[model samples]
Target: MSRESFDLDIRIDPERQRVAKQRAREGRRLMLLELGVAAALVLGFLASGASRRLKAALLGAGLASPWLLVGAYLGLVLVGYALAMAPLGWWSGYVRAHHYGLSTQTLRLWLADEAKSLALSLVFGIAAGEVIYWLLRTYPDTWWIWGSTFLAAASVLLGFVAPVLILPLFNTLTPLDDEELVARIRRLAERTGRRVAGVYTIDLSARTTAANAMFMGLGRTQRIALGDTLYSQYTPDEIETIVAHELGHQVHHDLYQGLALQTALLVGALYLAHLFLRWGVARFGFAGPGDVAALPLVALAVGLFSLVTMPLANAHSRWRERLADRFSLQATGNGAALARAMTRLANQNLSEIDPPRWAVWLLYSHPPLAERIALGSEAPA
Candidate 1:
């Protein structure tokens, strides 16, 4: 046989090929199962008179006293957290990550991390709920509108605070001190007219194998954070590309835009929630707002709202991600490097190369790797 023909005969081991295909199938199956279960839960809530019961409970509790209403809400949140932790926290978050070779955390460490996150979430959730309740009382005629506005303001406040206050609870963050890499990144930031206050690195590898880089904070506190795994695994050029992409988010004001968009969405959702709560209470024979028995009603309403809005939110996020990818390519002038970085990150995370369209539409916050790479390559060098 000719040398050319022999070279073309490269083959994959049959067993390895089978395993690869099986893994792909399994990933798709799991994705579908997750979405399906979420949808079923949302539907069940709507059908089961859950919303009405919760509204009645909330109303009764609120009428009795503001403190009573707050207590009832906290109780509901604790119960929901307990239910979610068993499956999502214990089994899915811990067991599945370990089973898939993605996690390096011990069970004790994982539990500790989960507890911290739960506490933070509870605090934030309660604060936000109290604000919403106050707004509802203040503007009984337009509770939804006013409530949404309050929620949006709270969300932005949280965003600004998360990197500085909340994030440190789970992982150690240290200022990036590698002189050579810092010099290169600072140079890049200067060229893009972005100030480089400092670079930070997170010990994400302590928990999961996922590789990521992010631009956090706003104004003087604004900084970039790179996962340790990213620094260790990727080349300098690849890291530059990733950093540049993150910087793009800052340059384009994506963070602020995202906050605004989310606020608008939440306002709409609150208005819809108000409408639905009234109907739900009537249909489900709820006991009036503050009743503990009405917790399920509230859960079902919120769950359904979130589920229905997933596709829209995912699409918006994907658009921002694509824009960032393009900006990165332009900033770094290295499409191939960015592509390589993306592929490496995906492989490290065991991400599916071509997830089902519906799944991607519903769940993905970033464009698929292939599309990102293609856009990067097609951009002017």
Candidate 2:
């Protein structure tokens, strides 16, 4: 190739590359710190007499008997969910978003939002647990297969109902009001051969600061939900890029794939749980099978199992996210814009720009922002 031709083909920038490297390092470091914190919390919960108190309470409540144990277990889980919701919403969803200036909602609104979430969680968790319990009793030898089937069905059913039922409880949904922008997005969807569903705006700022857009449901109820913050904060082009990313997920069948993977994982976990339950009951002084007093012991075993599998699960999710990023770039034809959007999102969310490699391996569902930006900027090869 001639010198001019070579120059035309190359779009490399050393300064951008250097910045990307620094961001990657920082991302890794931050991930490590987060993982350490999570581990410490888990250990503290086990060591601070909380686990023992729970076990004692269950036992004293007649949970040691197989018949009454399920009720006891359910009660414990309800209390745990209630206690955890406030801190989880504040730290994971609210405070971090506010710290990064992404959230616009007041504290009262945020708490109210969390209250709705708690209600939803309680309903779903109890229902799912009861289904599992029933499956174990009815199909002891084939619970894994039946359990997977049930879980998959439940996921699809929930996906359809959530937007219409659970979501409206937390935020008001209104039709998108921008006619011109809606027209442009419709054109983009048409050009990409994607089915254009109704576009709706969610009052997300009423509860939290993080901005997002999503594609929800399947078939007729399938619609696009754009957070109010995304509409107000991002320019039209940026919003288009975000919408394209969500469309990419749909195009790539990510939702179905994710559900299938989760079902398989759950089946495997339950199989192992069955095996462990046998030995656990023998050693832990609990009645077999439905003994509620042993719920804490079962949870402890599952927690340890999940901790060991964390890195593998994180890697799988990161890979899927990277694929979605590529699909967004291809669909939008706005690679640089997507990169800018990603950076803005990271900055706005106070996401650790740099985290340790070990931390990313253990905790992150998305690749480091630096990696995503680089991929966004790179030319197709």
Candidate topping lDDT = 1
Number of backbone clashes in candidate 1: 18
lDDT by residue for model 1 (1-381), tens? 001111112222344334444665766566567657655655565476564455456776555676566656565756564564356446567777777777888988987877777777677767766766565556645767777777777777777787888788887778976777788888888888856546788888898877888888766667789999777777777888998888888888888888877887786666666666666556656544333344445556666677788788889989998888888888889887777776666566666655668768977898876677566556666
Write one digit per residue (lDDT tens) for candidate 2, span 210-272: 567887876566778888766776667667777777777777777777777777776667667
Error of 2 at 26 (Å): 13
Q: Per-prediction RMSD in angstroms?
A: 6.4, 7.3
- After superposition, candidate 1 runs with Cα above 4 Å error: 1-64, 286-296, 376-381
- Candidate 2 ranges beyond 4 A from true positions: 1-69, 84-102, 138-141
TM-scores of the candidates in the order shown: 0.83, 0.77
For model 1, how big is the CA root-mean-square deviation?
6.4
lDDT per model vs. reference: 0.70, 0.67
Model 2 lowest lDDT segment of ten: 1-10
